[model samples]
Target chain A: MTDIAGSATRVADIQAAYLAQARSKRVMNLILIVIFAALLIAGFRTADRRNAGGFWDGLPNILDFPADVIGEAIERAHLLPGYLIKYLPSLIETINIAGASTLLGAMAGLVMSLLVTRGLGPVPWLVGPLRRVLDILRAVPEIVIALVLIFMLGGGPVPAMIAIALHTTGALGKLFSEVNENASLRPVEGLASVGATWTQRMLLGVVPQVAPNYLSYALLRFEINIRASAILGFVGAGGIGYDLRNTMSWGAGKFDEAAAIFLLLFLSIVAVDQMSSILRHRLTHGAKPGEIHR
Target chain B: MSAQALHQQTRRNFNRKRLMSFALPGLVLGYFAYIFMAFDMAGLGVRVNLENARTLVSDAYSYKTHVTQDNRTGAVEIAIEGERKGAYAPGTAPGWVRLGETSEIDLGGGHVVTFGGRVTYDVPGYGLVMAEPGAGGVNASLPDGALPDFISLSKNRLMVKTDAGRLTVTRNRAEVFKYSLGWELFFFTLDSPYHGMSPGALFKAAVNGEAGAIWQGFVGNKMWRHGDVGWALLETVLMAFLGTCGAAIIALPLGFLAARNFTPLGGLRFAARRMFDFLRGVDGLIWTIVLSRAFGPGPLTGSLAILLTDTGSFGKMFSEALENVDARQVEGITATGARPLQRYRFGVIVQITPVLLSQVLYYLESNTRSATIIGAITGGGIGLLLTQAINTQKDWEEVSYYIVLIILMVMLMDSVSGWLRRKLIKGNGGGH
Candidate 1:
């Protein structure tokens, strides 16, 4: 009985030693993790201080100016009634900018895409340079381009359309090229073998395969363009961004109305998102391997 | 037999037509270039540089351009192409140009006679160039030493390189950059005695301008007394660097958690995964507005904006990385009766560090541009300086310098990230 007890104690000692070593290893890992976390925390603190002015400077105004400036306006304009009347109309106008820009941009994109693919067929040394030009157009954002147009057009929707269209062309051209590359090579090659023209091949063999995806992408871009249009208004390009900026600047602290606008925009975006998925799924049904029979 | 020959001839004609098919691309590019230059001139700062040679007049010059024209001749007022380009063109008139106190005569047919501090002619539109001020000489014969930063003497035509791309300058008319810069890194931008302008042309107008025959172009600027360009530069770099670091901190854990394959199916993990997509769905600038509102406006806003946006972006990416890992290792751990967490820690996490590091580095590099835009909006960093430059729209030479610095910074960041990506992720396509 004593021998049996001694053996049990020895086994217990070995188990405890192994457990302690394991615990120490975990503790070391935890220490390293803490150090990393501390470093990140420090970074955030520094970043916050650097940006403190952005949040704090408007505070005294956010609180006091809302009462001083906006309170009078609210009383003077008859408050709730005036805002309620103008809000939906203003929102619609903002929506209009997105609609117009997206339409114009999509059309331009379609044409530019054809040009990018050399659907008309490779022409000259200058054609190679066209790719370069497209690169430049794609590199700068649309709003930046719009700023220039605004100067030329004098604060209107024309510049906004131009900017959106130029960007859409670039983006679509890229997508188009990718589509062209992925199109049914056999059909296109078969057309080519018969000495069919570049235009013929593109029209018959290429466009069909990717048209659905292209449409879906264009719709997606339109949704994005809507939001972008709203923002560009801040720079005086024309849209709700202008209104948002003015209201905020004038201390129109009716965050409820603002919140409503945001909510509407969010819903629009979500609807667009769901639509895109549905459309894309329909277009590429069973695109995943083994999902459907060829 | 003649009929057969005729049929062969027709087939040959069709092939030739195929080659000619690309001619439209040239027309398209030509039209695009024209529109770009025109918009830049109308006080929209959009420009495009082609390898520091000639301004493609796209992204290097004008900084930005927006115009709506239908086919045929798209009439847009271009700022033209030079630091002093639109100095002759007036400022801030709706339809008319200022045309400054300078005069340019378009000799109609690819020749422009320019008069300011110097008299010179640029060849009509690139492919060949010459500026003749001295008696009886082509651009090549213009007294030995007047060439821009990158002039190609090898070609029969004189090509002046600007924006890191050479162009046969002034084959048409003298245009200008409506911006200005002081003697800030002037020598670096130039390749020593570049710009075929005699010292008289470059320096004669400056307050302490001095002119010599061959290198007389040494002029000191007095108009742009330094206000706030230097500190702004440091802030710009810091904004980009800190923005990237902050983003990485947010991205790493979320990336792991959001990874589709690694995370166990539960409400908590599922919510985290969905959060990644939702965050990434919105644009970076949009986030800037929200965070700037919440965190206050500054580089911090820009940085946080980037952090939030990139967390979503990287989470989606890391999830894919986790999915792509070799499953054999996980199987080995599981066979030993390791817990799911242990299997993940030893099997997946250890393998994907390199991928995470490399992707984070790339995102950091990309965020530099985002940082600039955010800074521009939030009123912080060099973008504030850039915004101020745009607001004034008169000192394009300075804008040019700022643009050059920004581009250089971008290049530096790209190279650094590429190096880091390569170092971390060996024998693989480093985080596309």
Candidate 2:
């Protein structure tokens, strides 16, 4: 009986220690939560203080601009189709910028990925420097290049295209290199044994293996590039964004035009989003459900 | 299934592949041709300003010192980059310039310029180019030889450009610009007592109790505004952090509403999902424009715009994650007599916390880049400063500086976010 009692007390002591640890852990988590909350609050307050308008004051007027634009758009509903037709060319230009940049960037990225991949690379010493170059290219926002180019090249779509392409090269190069690392080197070795050039080896041995994944990533980059190109247009690079800026700056009178541009942009983005997602899904999954293979 | 039939099929496949190979390149070339025309590539050559390119390239790495003399008063002034902020004090000038009745500027390479009642540029290869500026306009004379292409003389203006320097004479003033390497007044302006100190001397000064003063000089540099730039960089980073974290926080519960397994109500899920779609589809540019209209402009507007758009993105992603959560964990929690909320806390939240945190951290780094672009649109943070510097067109050095800082800022954020993701989501086994 004394032995049983001693065992029970020992078990109780262990339970007490576990509970204490649990309690301390909870307390530490609570403190961390408190600190995080404090940081959020402080950061918001600082941002508000630095802002041109206060949050509360702006909250009520948040919907006012949208409402006004929508109201005018509805009031001038008949002109909507005409405005859409008018801006169609600009929209096409924007899409072209995105598409061209994606194509050029993807090509550049393919070269860069092949150059940087450990197994495929010709010059091992260049890999680190090339990676750093990509990082720098990625780090620079498109607007910086676009704005600088605007200074030298003047306001046009070319600046935005170059800017977006440079960024896409960096982004897609990184992704492509990651894809490249997983590729089998047996084909490359076979090609080398057959006396193929470096270019021929990469094109034949690796390109076929990673083409699907590369296409999927490039499609995603194209989607992003569309948005980037539009944003660049807002800052004096030519396109629909330029038109939007002009209409917006025109204030109340041109709200209808602004609305029209907004609808067009929204519809295009959604369509692209849907189409690309479906394509990506198909690429990854090989085919749709119950599709005939013939 | 005969050998002949199989051979025919193989031939067809090979032919189709060959056709595709040729057709793809042809199509790509065709598209490029179309784009070249559409984008007016032919006109771009004419549109490109080589002079502006030269200025931008040179100004990014080099600065010019200006020596100017008033024709009426003969008051001479020496300034870096010809900015009023970089003016030399009275009775003081660069070593190459000798301040006297006639300010004599040694342009190096045996080229010299003197500015007073008369402006004289003594070119080493050529003879003296003299110009007298008065109310009657600049009367100029060049050496009695074949005039070099670098010298241009007219009734009102006389200009001489050489490898050493450039001299321009007009009725109102005579100015000589001497080109030099490196950014001048980068750390301390002319007013700072430690302006001309070498790095070794600066260290010695700091050791001798002048560290604070030296720091103040650097921070308060009239030419650079390092302190303000630093604050702007911080604001940009803060915008990204606050926006990303706020979006994640706001989206977590909404995600529960949108997820099929969590919400149970089809109507509520549809509504929530549609709201997410709408927010995301509107895009950040539109949000920024709309928000800036209300909030005027600042880092707050930028952050809010980021928050609003990212909330949509996070909502969709989080809901998807929630829908994929393992039900076994919830069952295990429930077997312990845990309440519904307790089950969710232990099973659902715990399961998705790593995913949510990693996604949020990833967005934080990307949003830093986005914040910069948004900051430009909304007139806040370093983007504002960068845009302003670029807009001026004359401040290429400042533009380059801001570009370097932005690159560093983004790389720093990239590494930091990557580090945090690794530290926080270890052993979670979720796709980043």
The candidate that achieves the highest lDDT relative to the unseen native structure: 2
Candidate 1, residue B117: Cα displacement in angstroms equals 24
Q: Indicate the worst ten consecutive residues by lDDT in candidate 1 chain A.
A: A285-294
Residues B1-432 of candidate 1: C-alpha lDDT, one tens digit per residue: 799999999999988877666674565566555544533434432322233222222333333211111112212233323333222223332122223333444433454434332334455443334343222222333334455445554423344434322323232222322222233323212222433344455555333433342233223222232334554655555666666666666666776676556567666578887797677565564566666555566766776667676677666666667767788988998999999889978877777777677667766665665566567777777676666766665445555556656656655776787886785466333233
lDDT of 2 by residue, B184-219 (tens): 899999989998999999999999999999999999
* Backbone atom clashes (below 3 Å) for every candidate: 73, 0
Per-residue C-alpha lDDT of model 2 across residues A40-78, encoded as one tens digit per residue: 999999999999999999999999999999999999999
Model 2, residue B340: C-alpha shift (Å) = 1.7
State the displacement of the C-alpha of residue B262, model 1, in Å, after optimal TM-score superposition: 5.5
What ranges in model 1 sit over 4 Å off? A1-85, A88-121, A124-128, A193-195, A216-220, A285-294, B1-245, B255-266, B270-287, B293-296, B313-329, B336-342, B350-366, B396-432
